[model samples]
Target: MLDAVADLLLEAGYDGLTIDAVAARSGVHRTTVYRRWRDTGGLLADALDAAREVPWEPPDTGSLAGDLTEINRQIVAALTEEPSITAALIAASFRSPAAAAALRSFWEDRYAIAAIVVERVAPGVPARPVLLASCAPVFYELVLLRGPAPGDELAERYARLAAASVSRSGAAP
Candidate 1:
């Protein structure tokens, strides 16, 4: 059912997604979907929750720049992919508080897991800002600014710059 929601979201977008569509897509009965999810927002939130349950871990790339570059590359790929699920979910988040909260929770968990890379940069540094410094550019350029998504090399450049900033700040050697 969650898969159906995701597929429907990708195929038709957030505004076009509907309970009937999801039910038909999944071959699940309408009443069952309604009983479980209640509405489109519920379905979206559950879909996000289901995604969160999937196994994921930040890369252990042997260096802060390497790890951050890998992370940034992933962001670029997700945003640039055809029928981008990440972009779709981000759009969906704006329309539904339930989906928003669920999306927020997903990021919170992702950050907590990814923060270990920052920890390697500085044992006790505030992880979020440092981590954000490395990856935020890709999102800002690709999503917010609607710029052409550059390949992973540009992502690596952002990571190098971020790592240099951290190093210059005496956070790491």
Candidate 2:
């Protein structure tokens, strides 16, 4: 069902998505979907929550640079490969309160996972900044510049820069 929702979201913007469309695509009855999801926002939130179940173990390459590089690589792949879905989700978050909440929860969960790696590499340092620094440029390029996401070379560079900044601040052991 979540896959169906994702497909529909990519094909049609959030405004085009409807509970009926999701039900039809998912082959589930409208009543069942309604009973479970209640409305489009609830359905989108639940669908995103379900999609988050994909495995995303933090990297353990024995160095902050390597771990951050891996994280950035994943981010680049997600943004470049699924730009439509990514943009749709982001736009929906701005348009709908439920989507905004769901998007926040999704990012919080992702950051929590990234924090495990950051804490391992730099004890006592806040991970959010490091994680954001490592991937924000790629998102900016994709969204604002309307260009391709930064490639692997840029990912590695961003990772090294982030790791260096944190380490130089004496945050690492």
Supply candidate 1's per-residue lDDT for 55: 91
TM-score of each: 0.94, 0.87
Give the alpha carbon lDDT tens digit for every residue of 39-131 in model 2: 778877887787688777888999988988988887777766854676788777777788889888988899888898889867789999988
Model 1 residue 137 lDDT?
A: 84
Pairs in clash, predicted candidate 1: none
- In the range 53-166, model 1's lDDT, one tens digit per residue, is 999889998998999999998889989999899899999989988899998898888888999998976786788887788888888888789997678877998899888877
Q: Which residue window of length 10 is worst by lDDT in model 1?
A: 164-173
The TM-score leader among the candidates is 1
- Give the poorly placed runs of model 2, Cα more than 4 Å off: 82-84
Which lDDT values do the candidates have, in the order given?
Answer: 0.87, 0.81
Best candidate according to lDDT: 1
